[model samples]
Target: MIATSVEQLLNNLEGTVQVKADRVSVIDSRSLQLKVDSIVYNAVFAEGLVRDTARWLLWELGQQLGIYPSSIHEFYMAAGRGELPKSCTVPAINVRAMNFNTSRAVFRAANELSVGALIFEIARSEMGYTDQRPTEYVSSILGAAIKEGFRGPLFIQGDHFQVSAKGFAADPGAEVNAVKDLITESISAGFYNIDIDTSTLVDLSFDSLDDQQRNNYRVCADITRFVRQIEPEGITISLGGEIGEVGGHNSTVPELHAFMRGYNYKIGDLQG
Candidate 1:
């Protein structure tokens, strides 16, 4: 059953967990796990401040339990340097609905399989229709981790942070700022892996491949710089850029080279 208020939620977790002076203490690990399931449910389904409080408590509990949201940047860098075996592809799951329960199941399966390189992601469009901001989304994922006894770094991602072509055409500054605002929010809420999709700005009317991807790479580079400037000191945010829109023409090798060259030139000495 979902608790209606923070007090009710605390009462429900009486023996399992304790909250005092803004600190959460786990009285019973096994029981707290079960109670966390309901906490996460309330975080996702409860209304108004109840939902907000639930999310806050869940985040606090997750911190105390050592379940931290982290980036996959270093791991990928290691892979790039050939330091790790290329045995499997990391799965990026988009949880549009049932954010808590679905994430719990994913965590449980990952725990059973000893998998660690899984990601929970949501797109900007998904965030709007689903009514899930970055904070709630991160809480849901972390709450699930706590419920399932999953430990270590949790990779939460902002997927397809795309710019709309029509909006960009009408008001380029507003459109870009919208994406930048979302990026700031997502990064603040523990989404260290961000995929910037400026492919919508790609102008195929241009003859040369570099010209075609000029706007795409330029805006992507701008966003990349913004991300680097605002990212947390110790953590390097993993970023991805798109050269072509999905369902459009497949990107050629030359197009990929063109995008990379332009992007690299744009972000001169910036390190991801």
Candidate 2:
């Protein structure tokens, strides 16, 4: 019966099918509405210690007057929720990197709980992270999803991915080729969508407006263009810009609205 339901759900989706971050993401408007870029530094990383990450998040929670993040990010539990996020467009959360066992566990939980897709971050423990190198880590994560008979969009986003200078200069086309190839590989291996990243932009600047826009939009275009060409099956691709400035987009609504144009998103509605 569950298998039949899964098939029906897959058959229903259209156009860049999205599975809400449902159980995977713990949404916090405080973090979401910040003006500067802090998630990268504040957000959990695949390499950073999980316990430490949780503790830091808890510490930050201490700072909050009333708001709190439920779980910083958990691989298995998030994966299992399989709930569609509550967004008309591009609303999702990532569970991030969990080992094969954990991922598998999450998949089951998601199905039982009725959730959408969970995001996975597969990479090394390098200070300067990049997906230029290959890994079985991704394959392991996807394998779990396939086993669960997942029928939703499984996104294996290329998070914080960049190629080394030597790798890039040696064979100028190598990195691009590798990423495209990886997208195919992930899809075949059971991933739904991809997020290609090729930027060095980490933090935001209130001073260099032009530089910030340049850095953010350029990467968004590059990522979107990469997906447009690959042509994956059952996967909708999107480029994430505006890695910073959610804190009301510079302490003011008007400035934030102006800044959103570069972020590749917008402030909708004409309501106060």
Question: What's each prediction's TM-score?
Answer: 0.95, 0.42
Model 2: lDDT to the true structure: 0.40
lDDT of 2 by residue, 181-200 (tens): 66565444333344444433
Q: List RMSD in Å for every model shown.
A: 1.5, 17.8
**Error of model 2, residue 239, in angstroms:** 3.4
Candidate 1 versus the native: TM-score? 0.95
After superposing candidate 2 on the true structure, give the runs of residues whose Cα lies further than 4 Å from its correct spot.
1-98, 123-138, 146-153, 162-190, 196-199, 202-208, 233-235, 245-260, 263-272
State the local distance difference test value for candidate 1.
Answer: 0.89
* Top lDDT hit: 1
**In model 1, which regions exceed 4 Å deviation?**
1-4
What residue pairs clash in candidate 1, if any at all? none
Tens digits of per-residue lDDT for model 1 on 69-130?
88999999899998888785789999989888899899999999999798999999999999
